[model samples]
Target: MSENKGNAFDFKLFKRLMSFTRPYRGIFIFVAFAAIVMSGLAVLRPFLLKLAIDDSIVPKDSEGFMTYVILMLVVLILEVVFQFAFIFYTNWLGQSVIRDMRQKLFRLMTSFKMQYFDKSAVGRLTTRAVNDVETISSIFSEGLFMIISDLLKMLVIAGFMLTQSWRLSLIVFIVLPFIMYATRVFQKAMKVAFEDVRNQVANLNSFVQERITGMKIVQIFTREKTEYERFQEINKKHRKAWIRTVWYNSIFFPIAEMAGAIATGLVVWYGGLNVIGGGAVTLGIITAFIQYAEMLFRPLRQIADKFNTLQMGMVAANRVFGILDTRSHIEDNGTINYTNTKGEIEFVDVHFGYLEGEEVIKGISFKANPGDTVAIVGATGAGKSTIINLLNRFYEINSGTIKIDNIDIKEYTLASLTSQIAVVLQDVFLFADTIYNNITLNNPNITEDDVIAAAKEIGVHKFIESLPGGYNYNVKERGSMLSSGQRQLISFLRAYVSKPSILVLDEATSSVDTYSEELIQTATDKITKDRTSIVIAHRLATIKKADKIIVMDAGKIVEEGTHHELLENEKGFYRNLYEVQFADGGNP
Candidate 1:
């Protein structure tokens, strides 16, 4: 991830980010205007102070003094009003930008192929979409506005100071180079410190999310103490990173303060000498010069602070753009037509590897008619599941062609290919919503009748009906409210609701008890009757009725026949697996 050094702040990526704000250009323009007005108002404060000192206090004109006092009071009120407006507009623009960013990110994430999720961590992606975008929003709202205001204030103050007296202005301006040099050093140190802090913070967030999700496993294994120690190490690293940032800031601020102080002292000393030497300088002009000197350095100090914040924001931006920049190994060619698709599937000498040079499926071929039942049985990691993934194009084959209805799989659009197939995975995940919503997944077109019919077909309707709220009953995260078998049943129902042209059942009944397994087996048989079905089975009994069974061993097919035919051979891998299982008891 750290290799993103070159493209972190790429101009192209920044331009792409800016395009998201195009829709809200009006709000952004309003924010800019408010910032400029607020900066102009800030400049009036120092001028008012000079007026009070030189005109009111140094003179004996009481009548005119009250008018200046009234004018100063009015300017202060306007300053406060404009400051409020500035905050409102920037906040509005920031939130709008964040909303747009989140929507775009989520759309991109979901549009990506499954291979992206396989290679990326869920916690890291979630943090990027949620936390990183929020950080960018804060920078846009407060950090950006502060920068604009500081720059404008500095320019306005410089112009006024030069008008008052170029000699004194020159003395004050000498500190500009020192401030710039000091800020440059601080900026580099702060950037490194903030980058470390950001990395540590992400690590801590990932650790917490993983632990929370796996809390049951931790308690079950009695490894709470071990997990706590691991968490402590990560937390300590984050603390150290933050401490380093604070230490740099502590040193930087005082150096800046002392430099500003020295510049002020020089201005006062030089202006006094000119006055005593009979140079044309009055009390009012000297007072204004001192006021302008303070104004000048104040914005410079803000710029220093803003530089620190900008560095932090850049770190976040780099992480975000890193995600956006990753090109998924599997992507649509944009030429595939998805308007029509047939259900036929064929694998021709397909070879695949999850890692380089280690094939999981090697030169195996098979075909299934539009409505055929094909069963693949193998030991763990023998490539049964990989075949189904290939059929769905979740992974691209290293060699050979996968075709549907005699058309290459790559020629079909991803959406068209996926829409034709439904998979009930071994591990089920249900969102935190009502049973009806979980099944429909918020698809407005899916009616309640459709959900109930799918649930009934999967033999889970009775269990749902027993609940007080029935279809409206809410499931907790990951369906924790239900037992494992119940979750599987609901997942089966959800898959069935889609009514796909093809179905892949991958150990779909492995988690259930004997009674639920019998019920699910019956439901599975009924649902697969006339569909193009593929089953990856570990339990021999579950796939005994398959029309054709292919047994794989070490990434190649070792046997292919009916269940009885393979048992009769007694020399193939399928026969060996059956003997081992039935030898323990009657059947699994």
Candidate 2:
């Protein structure tokens, strides 16, 4: 949530925002045309009143008065019609623009490398995609289009006033400089206030989203009071930021009303003097001038108000655009498209770090041939998961080449490469959707029968069938309704159905119970039957049957052999880890 730190309005940023509306140019153009028409219609009302007063009422002709009154009604009806059209088109244009922007923002975010999300908060990004885009909607719905219509009305009214009585019009113009100056001051103050408000809003959204998502942890640790106090601090800042905007509004509006009142009084006094002088200004003209003065100054006040909406929209645009402009993205320039990968992975002298110059995977080299099962064993942060990340190209390696089927992995399109790899993490995540949808992930090609077949093959179909609605049963958010083992079994079924060439189980069963772990172990045996699989786990029992065992410590591989071969080395890292775990009565 970055603050817009420039003038009240950043024209350059605004122009960039307006570019998103190009796709809906036709609707936007119609909206502008409607504003012009509405403004013209609004100005005509005062002129019609003048005509009725001088030509019908003053002459005391009842028939002419009726005709003029009907004409005034017609004008009012037309204004109402055009005003409706204005509202419709402006809102349509707003919805259309934000719809495109929100989609683009989501697409852009999803395309970013994992490194970007590694540092960014989920709630902050959610705010940008949902809340900030809604603010941009206000730019058209309540701000820009309406401001244009109001300004046009003011200009047209001023033109009419000049024609009717320049003396009184000049009196109205005298207060213009003061009001304009006050508005400028108010706008600058409000802009700062609004930026603060938006920033605090994003912060609050981030805090609440994180707290709610991690509520189990809060309650388990008995931290409800502590978390509540933290939330209060953030809530207070949000309130204070908004109150600042309210304070500015309070100070500015009264000044605008006073200016409008003074302008009206001056028009009355000057027009009365002109009429008393017995030559130019008529009663109808003085009366029209008073109405014209209100029209002229009212928009000035409204423009100040609308400018706030416009400024908030601009700030939102700035924040949304900031993410869109981020270069923290993986360049998907590879043109190679391999539909069926052989799944022969080779990491040659791969050196990489999530942060600069601090290697996570330090000069590591490994190879997994087609249909081979390679298990990676290491202490936490010993670069075991980092190896899997690099293999999948989630993060770019600092130096060295990772090849699949003897071709550089960088040469293949990301989709073509990633489509062949399926990963199941320890913390399995399921959507707030049905069990079938969670397994299929909305893939149109993955039929319910295919999911059931895959589930049966992986040994979870019986468990799923036992649930209410079976495959159609809702898993709720992140599979909250299912046990951890049940969720992991679903993850296995999902991977099994994908028919991936390479399978990765990154501590996939580490968090499940004994019954679930046994079920998952059976699922795992079926899923890894004929794939180039990389299994990274502290649970040595899961990988004892793997073809090759790679042992690592302090970001380097210390042993490479079968489970029995590694165990024969008494001084080996794998042997020490296995001995320590077995002594603790842990399955290994």
Candidate 3:
């Protein structure tokens, strides 16, 4: 949300934005050509009026009058048709360009490593993708194309005025410099105001989205009154930012109109004096010049306003490209697509830090042989979850090697690597979708039959069938409609249905009641029968039967053995954690 100061628009960024139009160059070229034609047509009507006055009315020729009138009417009709086409096509172009840009940006964001999302604000990123892109749409729709058309109209009208009477044109010319000066002042002021407006709008969107998303927490804490007051303050700033723009409009537009009026009065007075003095000035020339003055000034004023639209579009382009240029995404450099994974995972001298110079996983090395279940038990911040994230390639380790079947994980294509592994996260996120869709994640390859079979295998099929719509029951946003235990069961089924070579369950049964935990235990035993499984849990009871238990403290493993063997060692971290948990009848 950093604002670029001054009236200096980024021409390079503007050019880059225009590059999107390359796909529709033919349409863009036609639109440009239409502007020129429409401008010519706009000027034609005033000329036709001049002809009707001079050659027909003043000369008292009825046939000449009718001929000029009919010609003028034809020009007006043509102008209207082109104007409609121009507006329609320009808007179509704008919507189309933003559509591609939003899709590209979203796809890019999906590929970024976890570090990017961890550091960036979700609400702000959402604004950039949704609100900012919509603003960029206005550039082509109402800003750039409209400005071009207005400029052309002004230039053509100015030419007509000069040709009709340079003396009358001189009156318009004299008033222009003052108006232009005021316009420049007004435009610079508005540029700053518009930038503030956009910032405030982003702030508003971000605030609303975050607040609503976390409304449960707000209501639980009884912070509704306080949050509402804060919202009013943000809303006030938004209103003030807009009112500043309105204030500028209120001041600058009247100045332009007053100048136009002065030019009009001067033209009429000077032309009357010429007629009284019996000079060459005609009523026809004076009439055309007056119309010419309005055409010239109004378009100029509009150009200033529309130019602001172009500038705002450039601002949006700058922010969008900034994200597109980010190097936070992991490079999928591996040539190998390793699909037939043996689920033999090895971490050798692995080290990682979410933030630079502050290690979270410190040189931890471990192995889970094919079909062996390994449980990771650690205090909070002891890197159990970090290990799971690294194994899934969500974040690259600062230093070390991770391998599956003795092949470096980095040597496998990210897609093939992730496809071979399924993770049921500590926080089970479900989309506001049917249970079937949630399990398959809308993946076309995972059919209803496939999901049902997987659910039955995991022993959750009956529980789901007991729900209102069975497989079709909607979970609502984040599974708010389902209990936490129910959501965890769905997560387990989702992972099982993927038919992965390896499974990692991070605190899977932490939220489950006794009944749900028993279901999970059954599901776990069945699911991990042949495939390698890694479980990170605070509840020691869940991992009692794990083939190997790795106890960690302060990001380093302190003990490694089976749950029974680790408990036998009196000084072992696993033994201490076990005593601490069951003694309190709560998680360690």
Candidate 4:
């Protein structure tokens, strides 16, 4: 996601973000019209004052003076109305555009493959969805529309000045080139600083989220002081990044103010000379010129400020578009429909690597017939889990074919294929929700009675009844409120309720307590009955009754037989693995 190193004003990205406003074009047009009207109305105030002073006040004409004052009042009222419309619609347009963009970004994120998430940070994606999108919003509310209005106001004021006195107009605008040059420099510097600030924000969020999620590990290792110091370092860098932008603001605004003051002083000094020389100039024009000079230069100052907002918004857009442009998605082109089938699976010469040229599953093949229980046993890094991952098509294989019931797995839609295969992993993820919702996953078709019946069949209904709220009890984030064994049982019940054609248990019994183990084994018996089951087990005793056992070593199938048949081979890998577990007094 960090590959977006774009310019301060990227026209390509600007045009892309503007496309989101297409739905609200009517509102955008209204805002632009209001801004133009407001700019024209703003220019009228000074002209009205000039008329009141020169045409009425000087000659003591009371009626004319009142007429001009009343006209000024009317213009002020119209300006207020137009200003209100400008602010309201611009803000409305900004919020509407961001709503569409946020949805698009989030929806696109959900479609990316698991491989994309493997290397991406959760906090970075969060920042892109929330903070970066908010920054883009300011482009309209505080940046784009306001810049247009200010630009129009400056142009109109400049035209009025030229008509009134060309000499004073030239004098007042002499410092403009310098202000513009300074603004450009400030803008370039600020772009880099704002990007740094955003990067640091993501870093800080990533560190905090990971640390909070693993707080137990930190405390168990007694690394509180170390972690605190690490946090302080990240926080300090975040502060410095923001201070850099503040430092740029400190320099730019003061220079803009100084330039405006200089312009006003030049106008006053030169216009005063014309009056002393008895030129065809009234004091009213000089006074009006002063107001006009301020009106013109003041927006220039604000433009510098608003341009900072515009730059940041564009940077954010670039970042968001980068994510949207990612092509790392699993293709779902299969036309096959999902239906009941006799459970069977076959892997033919399958080869896969999580990273390029680092094959985890190399030319492996296996088969599980209908109602067959197949257990895969191996040491860590022996590619036991990779097979299950491949069966689910979580990651595309480098080269191979996996079929179910004599049909290629890729020929069926991912949704259709996955609906028939249920997997229970060692680490179970539960939302901060009720047990019933977690078990049924909020499936409307699965009633409470269905859940109860399934739990009872698996011998876990008694444990559920013992809880304070029964099935309604809340399991907090990641099921932190429950013991490891209890959480495993919930996962088992969740899988059982799905009624899958094929069930996979990936090291589901390795880390649980004795009581949990017994409950899981009972649940396993009920779930795997009359279905094709794949058990990846670290404990040798858990799969002793399997119809077939495939022992993997270094990504190759070294032994394949029933438990008793494999045990008959004295030096076989499976026999060695089982005997070693028994020798260490571990479960076997």
Enumerate residue pairs that collide in model 4. none
- 485-544: candidate 1 lDDT, tens digit per residue: 777777778778877888899989887888778767877877787888898888898888
Q: After best superposition, candidate 1 residue 582: deviation in angstroms?
A: 0.5
How many residue pairs clash (N, CA or C atoms closer than 3 angstroms) in each of the candidate models, in the order given?
Answer: 0, 1, 0, 0
For model 1, the superposed segments whose C-alpha errors exceed 4 Å read: 1-19, 268-280, 334-342
Q: TM-score of every model?
A: 0.93, 0.98, 0.97, 0.95
Two-way lDDT contest, 2 vs 4, winner: 4
Q: Regarding lDDT, does 3 or 4 come out ahead?
A: 4
Error of 1 at 26 (Å): 3.4
lDDT at 386, model 4: 89
Model 3, residue 156: distance off in Å is 1.2
lDDT tens readout by residue for model 3, 1-588: 334556546666778899999999988998999999999998998888888998899999999999998999899999999999899999999999999999999999999999888887788899889988998999999899998999899888888788878888887899999998998888778778877887898889889998999999999999999999999999999999999988988998888889989998999999989988989998888888888888888898888778778767877877888888888867789878877568899999999999899999999999999999999999998989999889989999999999999998888899999998999987899999999999999899998889988888889999999999999999899999998888989999999988899999999998888988899889988888888999999988889889999988889988999988998999878888888877866653
TM-score of 2: 0.98
Off by over 4 Å in 3: 1-4, 585-588
RMSD of each: 2.7, 1.4, 1.6, 2.1
Q: Residue 439 of model 1: what lDDT?
A: 82
lDDT by residue (tens digit), candidate 2, 1-588: 344464777888878888988988888888898888888887777887888888888899889888878988998999889888889888888998999999999989988989999999999999999999999999999999889899898888888778877877888999989999999999888888888998999999999999999999999999999999999999999999999999999999999999999999987887788778986888888788778888888898999999999989988898999999998777678899856567898989989998897888888888998989999998998999988888788899999999989989889999988888999988899999999999889999999889888888888889999999999999999899999889999989998899999999999878889999899899889988888899999988889999999999878888999999999999989999899889977655
